[model samples]
Target: MASIEKHGPSWRVIWRYQGQKQRTTWATLDVAEEAKAIVEGYRGNRTAEQVYIDMGVLTPEVPVPTTPTYREWAEKWLGSKTRISPGSRARYKQQFRDHIFPTFGDTPIGDITTIAVGTWVNDLRAVMGSPKTVTRYYSAMFAPMKAAADQGIIPVNPCKATDFKRDQRADDDTGEHKAVYFTPHQFEQLRAAFPERWRVLLDTLVETGVRWGEVTALAKMHLVAPTKRTAARVRVWRAWKRGEGGQRYLGTTKGRAKRSLPIGRDLYDALAALVDGQPDDTLIFRRADGRELDYSDMYNDVWMPSLIAARRCATHPPAPRGEQLAGATGRCRDYGGTRDSGEPCGARVRPGTTRCPSHYGPARNAVSMCGCDGVLVIDQPASWHDLRHTCAAWLFSDPRMTPLMISRRLGHATLATTSDIYGDLMPDLEESAVDAIADARKSAQGTRGKGARRKR
Candidate 1:
């Protein structure tokens, strides 16, 4: 015999199982109906209630997991009983807990859809999260769902190839220009603004575009002697933990890291001094006392504070606008202050415009230093890296270099990627005015020939 009754707002179904009353936690009336059918079927069959069989009338197609909840699967995806970086794994857990499972946690993987993900992204974006992050989290959060999809638990992965819109968080906060970085002169000014140790850090970053992690992972072993045909080199073979724990890894780059860069003689001297008398195992970058610095440790304790000390952020004036004082001459003006000074004294800034030309000098922001002297930098708006754009622009303009070769040297993954960044830097050699003038000259020559024939 079984008993059925109502409790609170929803109907509660109770029954006798092994001579004891049992209740179902069907939160809704619709759920209760399906649960009631399952109970009734079991009662009719006289089957024991302890059995763990697939049973759901309404969502019959979705076979019940022994326990259907996101919390169960997420733990498994965090790498069960394995040795991985704490930092990396924490992010995995955070993404699942914060983003994915909350929205679709209760829904069966079988019913997940592209539209569902799209809608969720829209809602999240409305709340002011960056679309780029949403996309990244989508990859990590759905690993289990991917497994479920493979087992026919779901039909498709809606997260792949998604169209994400850029977020306006930075714009909303400070109203900065969309692109920011140093020009050669500004970088020189900012670099000169830095202390010796911090000078090395900023100069390297402006030169290589290396991520903070790669800089920490750098070791004396990475540098090799130069050969006749090739220049001296340093390799980006490892990185400090990008994951949760402070574990160091042998290989992995974050956001444009892990590149083998040619160290010009000037940059090489700075690096060589840092790693002098150290074993191959010792890192190239270090604290003042020569201890290996973790990624965040360097950025917080040293990098940002150094910028503060140098007054880089404080001295920044508004960006330069329109045509700069320098024309096609390519001859730079005398702005004082070196990269190690951090003053706004000697930069080639156009007053009130956002342009800083030095950061993008000949080396592509690789080592865009200026030789100008005396003036202390007052204001800067662009970043130390936007100079890379300035440098990339120069490479594209020269007919002697192809975009492919330039992209390879720049460590861009593809020609298309390089083109996206620096394509417009190359002008159309088509020169309509030149062609029109040539046509006029040819017409004049023809008229002269006709006149001579008439005279003959």
Candidate 2:
């Protein structure tokens, strides 16, 4: 039995169990009444102590652990990732601060539901407008929640329960381009676009398929000069990486795996020339000042400029509507384009435009060609990683190179990873496979016919 009585500044709920009286205090009459009702409801079958625990008046013998908030648990999860690279740690921190924390930081891990995760993903897609970026951010957030579920802190991982595959299918239906890699001829044009000093760097990238970090971190010691009986080899053991505060440092390769890549004699000689007379520890590809190569400086100052120069597009000054204009050539007029120097934009404008595509705005085509030189315009831009893809593309073109061999050459973690990425680029290999099957079937049929004739 239970009852409530008004006390000074507080209300008291009283109950009797095992012939003893017990009481609990509440701040409000409503809470007091509710506590009384809870105790009364459970008094029939449950013991007094159990009723007291249900009423929030007493602690149970076995304490239940409190479920941590997403933020708290995520911090624990991050701390547990001792083996992740510095760059990965920085990226995870960024994702937590900028993306994950905003949505579910304060929510209890147990309270995070699949519907909530789906809604967050949809919101991220709408705001970010890049499914790939959304996926990257989501993966950072997913790992923590998954750990929570594994530890039974939550019933299940909401991130995993969310229908990401269905969303990906929807993205595919929207006709997103899956990959970008240049043909050998296109790669040559791009290589020729670079200056003589940086040409070997581009060649190395397209030839070996090493990552930007790996290529930039190359030292003289990594290169093995060509021998009469064996081809030249480059050891990929380290890479330049960013850590906390964006400080650059030498780090292990992406897979933490060391590999040796065979290079052509010409490429080997060129690489050797770059490091000639330098110390064994000196970077093969370095800045004019002998400092490490910075990606932003190289991309904006060198890579993009070279790409535009390769286009060799015709350019014209701004002309009034219906006015016939003579062609003009030179630097972009857009303000603050180069290093915020406030000078005219240095990026080359496409033919018939006053500003470069960056300032001129988006084009409405997958590819555009320069009317003058028939060069592919920069509408479908490629990144440094595309050079790695280009290497894979070239390797896949060779019938002698199996996916497993290509995987080893590319330093991919597994053959499946190689297939997943470059599968679409292997149409010729697929055709060869079909041709081999047909040839085998024909040989089998010929043998059967010969046996029949011998029996006859």
For model 2, residues 1-456, the per-residue Cα lDDT tens digits are 687888899998787655667777889998878877776544422344655577666888786456989999999899998899877888998999998999999998866777788889889988987767887888887899888878877656778866674225364753344556788777777887788888898899989999999999999999998788989999999999888878999999887867999999899999999889999999999988889999989988888777766765445222221211246344455422332455666776545655555555322221234344546444467777889888888888888889888898888888877866676877788888899999999989888856454544
lDDT of 1 by residue, 63-88 (tens): 44443344555566466636456666
**Model 2 misplacement above 4 A:** 1-66, 166-169, 173-179, 313-379, 440-456
Best by TM-score: 2
- Cα lDDT of all candidates, in order? 0.56, 0.76
Superposing all C-alpha atoms, what RMSD in Å does each candidate have to the true structure? 18.0, 11.9
